[model samples]
Target: MQDFTRRATFGLGAAALAGRAFAQTAPPGGIPRAETPPFAVTPEPGASLRIIRPARFVEPDETIFRANAQRFQDKFNVPVRVDFVGWEDIRPQTAVVANTGTGPDVVIGWSDDPHIYAEKVVELSDVAEYLGKRYGGWAFLAEKYGKRHNTETWIGIPIGGNMGPCVYRASAVKEAGFERIPEDHDGFLKLCLAMKKNNKPIGFALGNAVGDGNAFAQWLLWSHGAYLVDEEGKVAINSKETVEALQYLQALYPAFAAGTLSWLDPSNNRAFSAQEIFLTSNGVSLYFTLKNDPGTRAIAEDTQHALMPKGRATVAPQTSTVMNAMVFRHTRYPKAAKAFLAFMMESEQYEPWMQGSLGYWAHPLKAYAASTVWTADPKNTVFRDAMENRFWSGYRGPISQASGAVAADYVLVQMCAAVASGQATPEAAAREAERRAKRYYRNT
Candidate 1:
């Protein structure tokens, strides 16, 4: 067992570099450091823990995650090796690594990875229990993604997730004759049509953005009370609700900016910042970026955030960007890997580390949501709510490897893209999505 002390200082060069493009979102106040008494772990005599994660584009996040890792490595004399894979490559790369049983001992993953690679990873029940007891219980959706279906076994340790609030130009919205942003499907549709008539259309990507595109498609479908699978995990992509969703998209397609079909994760962000579109579904990154730059600060000030408009269902957004830490079954240093995770989640480290990202990341625990970061800014509070309202791509169904497969295949995005491009009718597109989902489910 060993005790660790919090490092009073963390570098912010990365955040400064990244924040230059967006207004700083971290609360101006500071957090008091807390001490962790002790914890036991059996260190592998000659082995080091290797961690692979998506390299964060935000400067602060890059600094926080990596600096802490290095500090942990130095303090315990347990060398930690970290490899940052790109966002586009992480899932498939992880699958390949997991399949071969040869890669990092620990990994920071996104989406439904816990289910996708359940057999290849170690059960993280111990870490989950510890964190839950130490820092209230894990969030509902966090637990949802980490646990194995119909079992209490945890597939990974939930750390954090991102929110996809509708970031829009409030002034532009007002200029279009709306006093406030619409809260329902009908009003939203009218607003978009108005904006299009004004030559300032809303932008929603119809491309293969693993995070943004997936969220866009799921948010629209779920808003209309449609789901890709039934509650029992059966294929159910073709329904009145789904057809309605597709038809809505078909109607809304011409209102979007050109080049939406070719969009990746960065497209909407770029388009929004460049003022090519007035509104889009994205994380806080774009809003923050607009705020930071003098050239776009006015747009940032005129910016207002909202949850996805309600359709026939609830007025919630289904966030797809989740972050988790997994310890692989092949690790020769399981104890060390768990210890590393334990260190990161401690209140003193976790709070400030998250703060560095300036509200770019959301809390996985209920307790941390009370932090000033969410309270200091109204927009932060709105963005943070996206975490609570989250539903992954396989909503109303089990988040199995099959659902993960569907996402990895970009099935939903492609289906929506087909109809948006007029290559397939709403019914035809819905049927195609259903067929593809069935194939993935059947193989799984």
Candidate 2:
């Protein structure tokens, strides 16, 4: 996989150009021609599949996804059952499936999940490679998440990412003495403090939020040039860099709205929509939620989006909720599962789903950058490059089972929360995080 910092320079213009080129030649309702043969895997007789995935954040996400599933069933004559659960419950449910060896045939799960249960999941290289060849290719982060550590084997297929950028009120930002959110950390902090001084405070999830908490904590850590582990997958969260990151959090925490210490994934969204918070980090769902409601139209109109500001890293270091599709080895219909996965990713099904998502799910395939979802709203354009700018869950290290365990345990989120809430000092929080992280990374 390419270094995301270097790949960040791959720029949206280049991606858009490539997308246009692919669109020009693509057959209507399908992918363009490829030298590789089409996916020809045959489903087994009496095939029926049960899939588990996180519930949708936006209505269109579920609507389009279920419709696509129905299309697959209508075309293949295979019965498909999909179960949507809360995002926080997904990991534990997937773990149950992995341990019991008899549950859902397919699991559409979050980052590094397939890595955690790699041994129990069937390889999908054929499915992933075929889609990559047809759709131009997977984004750099998509390829990283799709493949296993130190090998070409693909344990899962990346569906897309729920990208959480900096969503804020434009007038509030201007009232705080900034024309726009700054791209550098000091300026960003000053803007936050200014917002608080002006009585329009910012807030991000600091509790056990599966998405928002992790995104904010990971961005805070990585932006300050810290990581839970180094490239060799060794625990390294006790350094001065880690302490500095925690201390930075301490400075920014006071500018947040009250009760942020207990805020969950939906808390910030609700707070932002109610005008209780002037700024937050969230998917475009927040904006659309406000837009679709007549009562909140003004707030929706005031909303704007930007990438997270850079710190010592001087690069985009945001994290996202990456969704991956993995088939269990215990499934009675592996070919059927693979075929279904392939069918969902084809241009016919994927393009409309991507657009219908209203920019909530960032595309994993490079070709979908041309989707009008990004162009229809200028505020959404920032997310089109989310996969390019994001670092995987285990930054500076190979994503593995340990990385998955660390994320599942919420070590980074806890460390940030501990320091921000004054439960621990910066140094103490870093040391505690180090000890906790080692429990998972020790074997690595």
Candidate 3:
């Protein structure tokens, strides 16, 4: 609201994408400054490529996708066919296509398998280096997804990402507060606890939705000041940070609405509609939910979001970052496919296509992120803010996906069942999670 990003620095490491969160304030320069790459690139004339995207994304307008297709074709003397697919189907289907020699050159789907170094997708190291040479390089991919900063090999690019945020009723918080809403995790959780004592719902409901359960684990990771992985690629979730995070959740459960375990994203929306809860942490879908429901729309008119409260240790899972577009190994048009992939990651076609599709994806290209043209849209600003400070859960590397039964295995799901139902002590649940995650850590 108050030029949020301009004043804040995000990523915790150097040469890491997180650092890009802060605007570079010029030092009393009577001298003019150089332009940022994201803001400066021009479409390559006679430069075009073919790209296949997830079908779920809204296709381009009669004007943009088609005209651009022709423009790239005419300019680069290549054809760009834009295809779509349901995200779930894109991977296996793409794999089959790749295996059968019929897959698309580029894919648009969720998750980035960084550990799978030689898999179908491209590692961004070469591209990151190229961008570094041409334009200033920020760790576009490094700091993404809570990964240790500045190591090499990025599997996915962030197109549009969602952050774990506490979307709350502004009016409700003003009603509960001692003046000035707190952004610290402990303070906010305390408020949630107090609200519950008064029989007020804290807006948390994850029933029937693995996503809410999924989000709960992530918020816990952030609050605990622990990470899923350590710098050495070893799993670290069983440590102090994770246990502390579990305690935080256990402490807050009593204050959540009565049927919280049954709460999903919709439950929170329902509570918001009924004016029953004060806050809940979740992704951008909360905005979509607000727009779709009539009663919620009224509540939406007053709802506000903040980055999920920062723990003493700063962390948040990169939800929806690391979009992968791979060149199928058995493709008929291998060279074209590779070209298309390179181009897709390039900003020229990337920006307009996603924007035209009404896909609220953030720019995956490091250069595109610096664009004033891209950030000029206010709808994009909060996203821009979320990107710098946030990260995706480091998904399994491209060679193989994590065997994480995320919906069922996610720690939050277990915590809610344990703490909310009074089945176990918070400490007990934390110990159990550590045990389960240790197995996953070994395998992953």
Candidate 4:
């Protein structure tokens, strides 16, 4: 496995080039003429495809994505069907397909999923490499998620990322005596405390939500300079760093809205919509939900987005839902599956789909940083660097089956919940998390 420390440096360099836009032109519904490389794969005689992926949070995201799928079908004369399930169900459904080998030919899943089923998925090095070179190369985290642990072999094509930023009410924050959300840990904690005292509490998911819950738990751990494992892949969750994280959570939990222990992916969204909470961490969907409704226009106007506060860690400890497209080896139409993926990633389709998403899905390729979506609205700008700022699921370690299992099992969420809910002390919670994490990393 490549050392993630070095990868971080490379990622910063790629991020620096994000603002330099590529100027390639393409005919309608065709690949860019100047950068186009011949995709020579032929579909099978009776080609058909089925794909399973997480449902969209924004309506336009679904509308544009389905339209792109139809475009592929129309061009290729092949049948295509796509199934959209809840975010929490994607992993289990993909697992079923991997185990039975009789379900969808393509599975678009979250972070570390390709690593978990690496052997069961077909290599897509051609598709990935072609797209990277055609666009301005893949972002650092995207390349890391798509490739196998220790080699350049591609197991998936990174589609994009679902950025989970700290979406808050600017008015409420200002009312709490802060001009803006704080960028440092100490100041942020004070802001949260003031919000709670003012009866405008913050909320974050602590339940088993696959997206928001894991994102928050992982950030809390990482921001405090703790990790599930070290760069060497040894279990490292029981250290003082972890206990300090839990201790921090203990101090912060009282400032959260009541019943946050049971909050799921939609909980904060619902709470914020009803004015039950003033601040929370969420996707742009939360803001769009308000903007699209006439009754909540005021709330939408007051909404603001920011990256999570940096902690003791050198880099921002933000995590996101990375979407990856992988073809199963059991597919009857491997070529067709790969071709469809390539078609969807083409700028003609991808750019519009990204624009329609309204910043809910951030681009994984460096070229997209210059897309109009980022500049379309001032609030949308923070998500523009989500791919550059995000840390992979298993930070400081190689992404492997063990890392996938640990995330899927919700070890970090459970640990945070235990301490925040007073079911366990920080020390006990860290030790328990260590024990559970070791069980998964033991063999790997």
RMSD of candidates 1 onward, in order: 6.2, 7.9, 10.1, 8.4
Q: Please list all clashing residue pairs in model 2, or write none if there are none.
A: none
Residue 365 accuracy (lDDT) in model 1 = 69
Residue 47's lDDT within candidate 4 is: 99
What order do candidates take by lDDT, descending? Answer: 2, 4, 1, 3
Clash counts for the predictions, in order = 7, 0, 28, 0
Per-residue alpha-carbon lDDT of candidate 1 for residues 1-444, written as tens digits (9 for 90 to 100): 000111112232343344333222333244332333355564666658878776664545656666666656656778876666666677877887788998888888876876888888888787777777666677877788878888889888777877777888888788789977777887888888888889898888778777788889988888898888888888888898889998999888778988999987778878887889998988777876777778888888988888778677655746648877888888988988988888777665577667767677787766676678787778878866545664765887888889888988889899899989899998999989988988878932
User: Where is model 4 poorest over a 10-residue stretch in terms of lDDT?
Assistant: 1-10
lDDT of 4 by residue, 107-180 (tens): 99988899999989999999988888877888878888989988999998888887788889898899889988
For residues 19-45, could you state the per-residue lDDT of candidate 3 as single tens digits?
A: 122212212112122343442223344
Stretches of candidate 1 off by over 4 Å are 1-39
Q: Model 3, stretches more than 4 Å misplaced? A: 1-105, 114-117, 120-155, 178-181, 194-200, 204-213, 257-278, 288-298, 314-320, 345-348, 353-359, 369-380, 390-428
- The Cα local distance difference test for each model comes to 0.76, 0.82, 0.49, 0.82
At residue 140, give the lDDT of candidate 1: 74
lDDT of 4 at 374: 85
Off by over 4 Å in 2: 1-36
Query: Using Cα atoms with residue i matched to residue i, what is each candidate's TM-score against the true structure?
Result: 0.90, 0.92, 0.65, 0.91
Between the candidate structures 1 and 2, which one is better when assessed by TM-score?
2
Highest lDDT against the true fold, candidate: 2
- Ten residues in a row with the worst lDDT in model 2? 1-10
Query: Candidate 4 at residue 88, lDDT?
Result: 76
